[model samples]
Target: MKVAPAPSKAEVISLGCRLNISESEQIRALLADENNVVVINSCAVTSEAVRQTRQAIRRARRNRPDARLIVTGCAADIEREQLSAMQEVDGLIANTQKLDSRAWNVPASSRPVLAQHTRAFVTVQNGCDHACTFCIIPKGRGSSRSLTISEVLSDVEHHLSQGAAEVVLTGVDVTSWGHDLPGQPSLGQLVHAILERFPELSRLRMSSLDGVEIDTDLFDLFAGEERVMPHLHLSLQSGDDLILKRMKRRHSRKDAVDLVRRLRKYRPDLAIGADIIAGFPTETEDMHAQNKSIITELGIVHGHIFPYSPRPDTPAARMPQVDRAIIKQRAAELRAETQKCRDRWLINLIGTEQQVLAEKDGTGYAPSFARIQLPEGTPAGRILNVKPKKLEKGLLK
Candidate 1:
């Protein structure tokens, strides 16, 4: 793997989301020639995220007192007034404009340098059109939009040229890509196009997808495509039917189960990951139980359990709220269940060979996104097949 020379002048502190990390790298390139500038690509997915953004702003200001500091990303747009009012914040760029070269008042670098990252993330879509009651992303991101297939191919080509062994298609609503385009191509078509165009590209992965929107074409690729990874992270917020309805989610509990079941038939080793909210408004004990049970039912080894936090102006915020203590307890229980499932799954993989992509962190990831401990001398960005004889500290080695 060829790593780009580190930038000397500009520094970026990416706060959240893989999309922000991808965008921050582009920002880094745009500012590569500039002097004494720092950018904070912030997130406002939760109140906690927004608070972290503020903390980052102050810390960046202290570290670079003479340098110009700029804030951009979802938090900067959604919490514009409050964040801009901070004395430490020099300026705020609109989230939508953050990617444009003009936003930084600089010509786009002739060659955008990818920061020290092993897997290149290529954002195919941005924004969300869905009105999930618990989400404030659409307000921050505006409308659902997609890059044209040609544009996507170009992005993939650039990453490949940068020596990216794996390319991940990422976005706010990745599965919603191409809906606003001319022919309304499905997400599967985008993946097919990339694989067809770049045969040398070994690994092609996708970010979280809306389970209900996994079209037949995408399902087929997941089931049989050798280059496409056998891992799927669904944007499933709850397991109880009522909570899903209240959240304005498109899929029912059964929809998610059936989708996973069908995909696993062709690829029995497929890994399941999900975003499960523990305590939504109006959630009862039974509702939380359903949420806990679904983890084992779906065999969700990589679970992201978010304790429901009310965001300003969201519908869920206005509804009857769950007690914070109970929410915390529920979140803990959900996490424990996920760990049990993961521990068992890892145990089952003992002595099984996995093709792992090494990262700079002295770790690697399998096609199913399972973490593997690499030998001490392994170089970054090399793909190797290794058999794990033990599981230690939640990593297969």
Candidate 2:
């Protein structure tokens, strides 16, 4: 006799970076067969992020009244008691526990459904070793840990076999991968291994990487590798040296500039992106000017501009704070500058051939990570080579 398939029983609402999104997939796999479970994979990068998380929790509770709402991620880990007190949150899982089979109460499984995603994000590393004075993530994510090279290759192979055209290596601090493992293999070695093992893998990408920790091998890969995507989003918190020092960031303004210049020398078309915080404590006008100037100087085509919002217990929170109004204004100005850079890049791409990974509804992303509107009815997950004839509504046509 034939049997009916099981119904959908779980849902995950991810509210953070690519790393969180990648982990949410694992959480979804763990709860795939369970009933009435809703997981809130939260973010706590800033106080605003924590507030948004709370809002998400309330919304999730309203929508899924019958489901058991589980909260997990940086916010949940750091603010356990506070989140636990929320009536909507039924359980709390730490960032470390999210990957543990025991936490899910299920047999260890590798069968993850990519579900509506053409690209698969394989988390090879987690947590951070360095403590940036402005960051609370290390507290939530714990010390650096890495999956062995073989384990990472296995996951990559699994995703490739499941028809993933692109595989992105994601983590809390991806560049710190392999430090906790045998021989302390570098991230570049891991990338080399993945490429060597799976020659047919279409595209390989990395999430945000710290500029200071990038190694020689990784630099060579960026210079010459065609398979590794040309878009790099850097974890550059500030472009001012004084701000960098205050934030306890390893890379200085000169370091960031030199890195970008070197990469662009090899791959001129490389799309550079960075996370810059505006109005950090004690930031003078001259410092803010330097921050604004770096975008143009480095040709940053993509930017994640964040208004400085202090988190409780972080060292920066105790520093003399910037006025809220000035912070917002500086953030706005930085965003405008970023937009100009992006528009300039987009203008340059006009009439150039773009390798677009078609996502949903005739929309996709180009190699430079720019949005492209493909011919209507173009199916998702198909990589198409087409010349972008013009720009339409901020998207390449």
RMSD in angstroms, candidate 2? 2.6
- The residue-level lDDT of candidate 1 at 113 comes to 72
Error of 2 at 130 (Å): 0.6
Per-residue lDDT tens digits of candidate 2, residues 79-135?
888999999899998877887778877787756565647889999988899978889
What lDDT tens digits, residue by residue, belong to model 1 across residues 94-167?
99998788988998666677665679999999999999999998888899999999999998998888788999
Q: Native-vs-model 2 lDDT?
A: 0.89
